[model samples]
Target: MDVPFDLNSYVRVLKLASTPSWEEFSRVALIAGAGVALVGLLGFVIFLLMSFVPGAGL
Candidate 1:
C-alpha cells in the first residue's frame, strides 16, 4: 500500500525553516568558531601531555 503525503505538514515545516538574519548568522558563527578553537586547543594539550608519558609512542 502506498502512503499518502501530508502537504499541510510539509507547508508547516517550510514555514518554520526561515532564513537566518545577518546578526543571527554572525552570532552562530562566532559561537561555532569558539567551540572549534577550544576543542583544538584541548587536543593539542593532550598531545603534549602524551609526549611526556613514559611509553605513549609519541
Candidate 2:
C-alpha cells in the first residue's frame, strides 16, 4: 500500500512566504548554524589541548 501527499500544497499555502518578515527567519537560522559551528570548533581545540597536556587525564 502507498500513501499520497500533495507536496505542491505547501508551495501556495502561505501568504507569509513572500513577505519581508520571512527574511528574519532565514537570518535567525543562519546565526544559529554559525553559533553551533563556533562551539564545535572551540570544543575540538579544547580536546586537542587537553590531549597534549601532560597527565591532563581527560
Who wins the lDDT comparison? Answer: 1
lDDT tens string, model 1, 1-58? 3234577777789999989999999999999999999999999998988989879854
Model 2 pairs in collision? none
Assess every candidate by TM-score.
Answer: 0.74, 0.56
Candidate 2, residue 12: how far the Cα is off, in Å: 26
Task: For each candidate in the order shown, give its overall lDDT on alpha carbons.
Answer: 0.88, 0.79
Residue 43 in candidate 2 has what lDDT?
Answer: 95
Candidate 2: tens digits of C-alpha lDDT, residues 10-48: 545774466556788899989999999999999999898
